[model samples]
Target chain A: MTVATFEASAPFHIPRWLAPFVVLSFAYIAVPFIGTNYLFEAILLPFLALSLAGVGLNILTGYAGQVSLGSAAFLAVGAFAAYNFNLRIEGLPLIGSIILSGFVAAAIGIVFGLPSLRLKGFYLAVSTLAAQFFVQWALTKFSWFSNDSASGVIDAPSLSIAGIAFNGAVGRYIFSLTIVSLLTFFAYRLVSSQTGRNFIAVRDNETAARIIGVPVLKTKLIAFAISSFIIGVAGVLWAFTYLRTVEPAGFNLDRSFQILFIIILGGLASIRGAFFGAALLVVSPLILSRLGSFLFGDLFNSGVLDMSQRIVLGALIILFLILEPDGLVSLWDRIRKRSVARLNKRKHVGRAAQPTQ
Target chain B: MSGFDWQFFVEVLIGGLLSGVMYSLVAIGFVLIYKTSGVLNFAQGAMLLFAALTFVSLVERGVPFALALIITFAVMVVIGIAIERVVLRPLTNRSPMTLFMATLGLSYILEGAAQLIWGTQVHGLDLGIDDVPFEVGGVLISQFDLFAAAIAAALVLFLSVFFRYTRVGLAFRAVADDQFAALAVGLRLPRIWATVWAVAGLVALVAGLLWGARLGVQFSLSLVVLKALPVLVLGGFDSIPGAIVGGLLIGATEKLAEVYIGEYFGGGTESWFAYVVALAFLLIRPSGIFGQKLVERV
Candidate 1:
């Protein structure tokens, strides 16, 4: 949809309204025209889904100030819930199953979030782990969740909203994009609303928030519920849109850590940070491995190279935490402010002094 | 399965306590750092793996066992001090969660470096202790488990004495009791932290050696950290004896549950059983059975 209308006064030049149009066209039209299916399948799709998960996590850990290490469990619950909904109920639309799956995940999240009332910080963190372990155990142990498959992996049905089939890579990418944008919009609205302020209040200090009449318990539960709902939707995207086959094993402790790292490295308490973090989390390893092979191509085999890549990844996480605790988004903000300030100063001087790089 | 078996129950209880000792060993590493500093050191598992791998690799390269032990200990001291200097010192005044995440990051670095230095093949660490079971009152116990429990007891005794008698130990207790007060009294916080981490590193070495022999020095060695977390939750994060008792309770309950009712849950309940136990315990006592009660203020 168009966000702004073009002005006739700027007809000869590109109007402000046309800027978003140009970007939208580039994203939807120019990308697929120039890029291959490999790019869509390998990179774009996963990036959107993971960023959505990061947003989901940022709601709880960043905004609510509750540290959780069991996000992957909720993701798995959503995927499996969607899978079951699609299977059990006949004639259900693709969107129907996805939304229902989110509710299911939210319910599980609330159950896990129950402990937050009694526990705080590291104690609560460990309890969330119980949710992680138990959910994975149930998913893998009960073959019924997998539709009686011994392998415990499910083949997600093909996606068709209304009459359009999103069976191809571009189709899936667009579907994921639409869903992510819609959910992210709601998340932005949610965080800015009174509910969002309560989240911040509780995060800052539960006792203070209570003194101010914010229902501490309710806010935490709502944070968990909303966070899980979004994460669950991301799970559906991860399973149905990105991966060919969905399995419980796909969402592990490592995946939880990845989402946590995304928020940590993206800067906590920011919406756009999730995107920056997701992009880096998804792309950095590929860059690291490629650079490793390029530099030490003949010296080490794949095993040694893989190990080195991990070392670099680990080192990078620490370096980023120490150097940029606010995340890459903060770094971006600094550069943007500096450049904009320089531009304004030059305009006042009436001389186009070359901006410092 | 039909009748209540008293003999089997005792045997399982004994075995669980012994395994609990192993867990307490790892938890001790966490407690050492946490007692002196509020940071929940998640890298304890990785340190265990690194120390074990270093020792086993040295021995593999024809170094004598005693020499390999000394070399591994020295390496652990250097790594501990380096971590304190680089990671812990800069991150000193951060919140517990931030420090927790940093240590989580540290785990990655340590795990990666350990595997990168020592090739990824699994190595069997032979501590030369026989695993044969000896029957006492018609209950069988593994000799190796008994040996590990004894070592854990001795280590606890030594630590208790050190904390009781030494000047540095008194400094550690003072810092643990109240960091700001200790600082006001002119205690050297960094040196004390370094010493604490070095001691933790040594604890990791001892844990590494024993666990390496039991589980084989492999990538999964780091997973022992998971076992220690529940132990920490049960025992309280900052208490040494809390760790020991917590480990025993968690170990015994999980084992009993696994044997008695595991089939109902389709078996393999051990993975999450300790966590479930910890969660249940948390509902009753958030700080743990013996952990210092946390007080919050505006």
Candidate 2:
């Protein structure tokens, strides 16, 4: 089906949520002007990068019905590819380097996605760990990736587009925000199209999707490629814009789990859920720390607090999976539906009273 | 080629085989859980770490070795039952992926709890066996390696007998074949699942002691699971025999590759070698060497 027809037939109208989403987008864009550098640098940049990664993962695991535990591998590939391209290729623009890195990541993604044709479910998920370990090993073992640095840590060069250097917190924020917004828009459009329908079909039932002429293998590969490309770009943003330097260790298995957790907690099969998940993951730790210090004062140390945070995070993940498998987006949708019902009842009551008068 | 020593190669092969048995110890836990419940228990590594830490900590507190072992076993049983009740029971009828993710969450909880309780300090676990290398047929072998292999062999023998002769064993096999059919026949799935998890926990404890003795009880003990993944993939996830054979194959090949070919790659090929091997094996037999073939219906 066409994107327009799909949207028209959707149970929930987009227009109802469009106003608040627009306002939120504007406020996000305006954050640099109104907020502190700490907010822009420490929080917003990482959130956007993680949100983009969540979006990438959401497309594959959420819509396409393939679970990957190696997204950080793609992210590592993206960051390193971008760094190498900018370093070796003379006169290559930074934007070109980042985009090229995405293509590089997509190529590797296709290679790893090959097994998904033969494997299903958790078997496929376990297989993806090969990608995770292999990529990290390659990046660490081969000194060339780090430009033969003894420490194996590489600094991301300043991001510049035609002499416009995104060197500061605000500059990096705007640059990442623009990239995320554009990619998110494309992701939304793609998911609403016939291709998106194919993903959902394959996810719901692969054999049925194949019988319906969905080209199951090709669809799975495309999902992998697209997901890798977006995640790869996020890696570039993470390394160049947020952290400004990285080692392979930075994108280890924990990072992969964190991104997966974001998508799970946000909502599967929803674009907006990626952002919601990212926000929760990034902000929750800050809130937890604040709460810990407030309640315990000097009684609890930072290390103890860190352990407590992990326990809380773990518990929350299990709780969400058991209680609200659809994630925060579905929770928000439920609340919205209920409020709308209550508002309609109030309006009907007012109309009936006026008629009686 | 001229300087290639046949003796060293033989020694390496023997050493790899012995170490492979240790990996089999861990992979067996995975197979037990997967066979009965169809859940890939990601928390197996964390359980290993927890079991090892608890045992070592108890022993360090001047408790007798046998007492410490019993207490650790009891703790694992409790944890297994608690998990089966609280996590897996509520998660019944959910997709395998959801259950897998829940196990991932369980891993985090177990890891955090282990560190919190045990103070995150690395401890050396001595199983009263000296690890000094002893010469055998012109090859150097560790006494500890021989001990580990013996323990693994005994565990396997005992498990095989338990599965064959016990009433619970019959129930386990019935459930593994068909959960619904077993339920129809008056078998309790929750109890069976709990039993399987407890068996897995017991396996983890044995693996933990052996691994901890070799590498010292540390956080990195959890990473031994990575080495076992190749074994799991190679041997089919649900087959006990697969875990054993796959473990041996992975262990031997990884060591051989490291010793012979690692020089070309500047060493450290052992880390990813098994995964690459498993990936290649998947290309040939997607179900693994002993895993049941996957059947899908529209």
Local accuracy of candidate 1 as per-residue lDDT tens digits, A57-124? 99999999999999999999999999999999999999999999999999999999999988999888
Chain B TM-score, all predictions listed: 0.98, 0.97
Docking class of 1: medium
**Candidate 1 Cα errors over 4 Å, as ranges:** A1-25, A350-357, B295-298
Q: After superposition, how far is residue A80 of candidate 1 from its true place, in Å?
A: 1.1
Candidate 2's docking class is medium
C-alpha positional error of residue A53 in candidate 1 after TM-score superposition, expressed in Å: 0.4
Compute the lDDT for candidate 1. Answer: 0.89
Residue A147 displacement (Å), model 2: 1.8
Query: Model 2: C-alpha RMSD to truth?
Result: 3.2
User: For candidate 2, lDDT tens digit of each residue in A1-357?
Assistant: 112233453333346456547856775666767878989877899999999999999999999989999999999999999999999999999999999999999999999999999888766887899899889989998989999986578898987888999899999988998899889989999998999999999999987899999999999999999999999999999999999989999999989999999999999888889999999999998888888889989866777777777777788789999999999998886776566545555666654422110
Model 2: which residue pairs collide? none
Report the poorest 10 consecutive residues by lDDT, candidate 2 chain A. Answer: A1-10
Candidate 2 lDDT, B1-298, residue by residue in tens: 5888988998899899889999999999999998898888888999999999999999999999999999999999999999999999999988878888998889888888988888778999988899898998899987888999999999999999999999999899998889899999999999999999998999999999999999999889988888888899999988999999999999899899999999998888887888888888988998899998862311
